[model samples]
Target: MPAPDLSVSATSAVRVAATVLWTGPDAPREIDAPIVAAVPDPRGWAAGLDVPARRDLADRVLTQLLAGEPVVVLEERGDWLRVVAPWQPSDLDPRGYPGWVPRAHVAQAAVPARTEAVVTVEAVRLEPDPGSRGDGLPSELTYATILPVLAETGTRVRVALPGGGSGWIDARACVVRPTGDGKHVEAGAVFTEARRFVGLPYLWGGMSAFGLDCSGLVHIAFRALGRIVPRDAHDQAEAAGRVPVGEARPGDLYFFARPEKSIHHVGFAAGPGSDGVLLHAPRTGEQVREEQMNADRRATLVDLAGRLAD
Candidate 1:
């Protein structure tokens, strides 16, 4: 699927899924998580997804290419996605951005044909909204979107999306440009650099645990170190591109949800291990601390959470 021409500004972070969702006919449904990426359905059933959802809908769609249910997907503008699922009505416009994508079980697609296997992975693209404070990157940039890159042999290493799907790239004809400082997300640097704020108080809407919200900690900690991230749980949920939580290194951002996986809160990925531990500013009058990532503990609230960022 080819993407439509849409305008984007520098400083925005844009993330693409390996697979995409198209607009559905008209079935109204909602998935879990704070930030949602969805496409509209002409009939009305849109494919919805959230990080907090059971299947991690966004991942399922992009990585697997198919949302578990029977649905159609459209490649929206560059870095944008859409959905078309059952229960949607035909009166809708599948071409427009109906907003949030829904949650769903997705099916994985087989590897691409040998002809399309030619490719290269570059630095992740973080697209923020237009006029973002990203310093020099696009405001709507997410992780990497197989943009057109030229290979030394004169062949184009066309980029696909984290959304799944490949295209051809010309080695010489296509020009691949470098964008953003990439400082906020140092590839080799684990989030360990952000652990300095531990013991700060947990405040509502607070940035440094001196009263911080889940996403607040992420924003403040990274920003303090010259790294920029999104505000709010939803925004952060779409931030820093995608990395398996299990594979997360220190300094990585960790999103948490109530038992519902609603993306209600977020935390810093302190270290790795099944201990499921994360660092955050505990709530009001509390201090920042490294708490267990116990699924049950996170539900009813655990280890006195805190706010971490701006």
Candidate 2:
């Protein structure tokens, strides 16, 4: 029998391709590809659109893929209805693979409340020793809490260092805004929201909005609206639903390894740049901040996992 093909999609980026990543197999059965064409529909990706638009989308996907992106194919409706996308592509991708081509498969993240909307900063909880820990630091960032706050449209919630353990500004003075428009929050909002829970207390296997672990915080952030995502970090990695991190959006989940095993910890990536600074929940004594996540982290977590999760 022939191997089944995976699906992928083009994120917000303009450049996307549809080159080869690799074949299917366990262990070393991985490959990389670029996006070809992007479509908001879930069924008629690169294929649905006209040649002109498809060509433009294809060129971009090629560049990114050749650049060593983790692209993959999702599904196919006959040969004409093929859906291609990056590995673990952002669930929020304007078009995740193809089913969403017509804007189906609704976004997983929830829309926060409108009343009492506010933008605030909460710290991330980290393990005592960033590198090592006494209780065997979690395999992945488990909890990064999210304050019970909301924002108004055009709300500007600013991000600032907590010099003395105080972080709350008026709606007008904030660095970002919060709303429930079903639209991806603006950059400033994303940044602010991402950084909002830095220096927070970390918990073991936590999943609450008040005191979250890495994956827990991510789950709450989007769940506030209406999106249902994986509960823990490892599964969160799988939540990408088939797209790769290379094609991930700002609000997408970023999973890592614990130098131990499985899908371990996960975080929310901010914008492109592959900075490696993921938003996650730390250990009992850590803070929820965008710390320096270097290549070493990837070497431990992602590289070993093999493929970008779906």
Candidate 3:
């Protein structure tokens, strides 16, 4: 589909009201248009997009947006729309995870009032009303899938869905995340939360519970614990304090990369000592699982480990 000319007037302010995908260039750029849809074009993506050096798995991917996440659209060229990401992608990528995304992946709409909620369960149904029997929404809300809180009932909270419309989700399945102190959260508790999605499929650039890449998994686990960390493995390595692998304990992160130049994959420590198993969301086609960081695996140099808390 062609891009919609939703360019706002100089005096009008704009914000994202839906969960759209960011498929822009690896370099920083921006646009002033909302996405049109969330369709993926595998052939087009591989043939046209400049692959980021840090992405581990080269599977078909799309960067997503939670409802009401703001973006600064900078420019439009052909069918691609350039925009600023709300989070950091990496140190090399400019200040706003700037990139070019297909115009088809977004549609312009009025920004709505919103609050953030994190998915607490593996998956939860989204209904049109505040009960299970209410008209069902099409998709399942997965663990760590952040949505904009709309209305709250005793046990359910209405949230704005990515595809549009409000859906009532069981409040028990999600927690309203508020901005505050996160340093008080313990590493063990964070690892416990990391253990929940033990069998999800790995996705490139995904950051939600529905499917997540290695760094995305790490990012979400910390976010669930209320501490927001960098979005990619390399950046996380720089931001968090590190511990030598031999001295690593539970709740520490095991970082893996080839030639030891940059951090690519990350796994949370789930066991103790040299015999510990690291829980991680591995690459494409692999389900998130625990792997014993024994002799052979560590040959890739699971040499560096990090602690979220210094």
Ranking by TM-score: 3, 2, 1
Q: Which residue segments of model 2 deviate by more than 4 Å?
A: 1-192, 258-260, 303-310
Residue lDDT tens for model 2, 27-71: 111111111122111112322334344333322221111111122
Residue 83, candidate 2: how far off, in angstroms?
A: 38
Instruction: Name the weakest run of 10 consecutive residues (lDDT summed) in model 1.
Output: 1-10
Per-candidate count of clashing residue pairs (backbone under 3 Å): 127, 100, 19
lDDT of 2 at 295: 71
- Sort all candidates by lDDT, best to worst: 3, 1, 2
- The CA-based lDDT of model 3 is what? 0.58
At residue 292, candidate 2 shows an lDDT of 56
lDDT by residue (tens digit), candidate 1, 150-197: 123444343422223233433433234332222333522424434555
Q: Could you tell me how far off, in angstroms, the CA of residue 178 lies in candidate 3 after the best superposition?
A: 3.1
Which 10-residue span in candidate 3 carries the lowest summed lDDT? Answer: 1-10
Candidate RMSDs in order: 15.9, 20.8, 8.7
> Per-residue alpha-carbon lDDT of model 3 for 1-310, expressed as tens digits?
1111112111111122223344444432222121232433222232232334225334323454433334556788876677765443456455445555555444443233435577787667766544523322334555655555777877988776433556777889888754232346578887878777788666666666556777878877776655666777877777777777877777778888778366667888777765668888877667789888666457665566888743
- Which candidate achieves the best TM-score against the true structure? 3
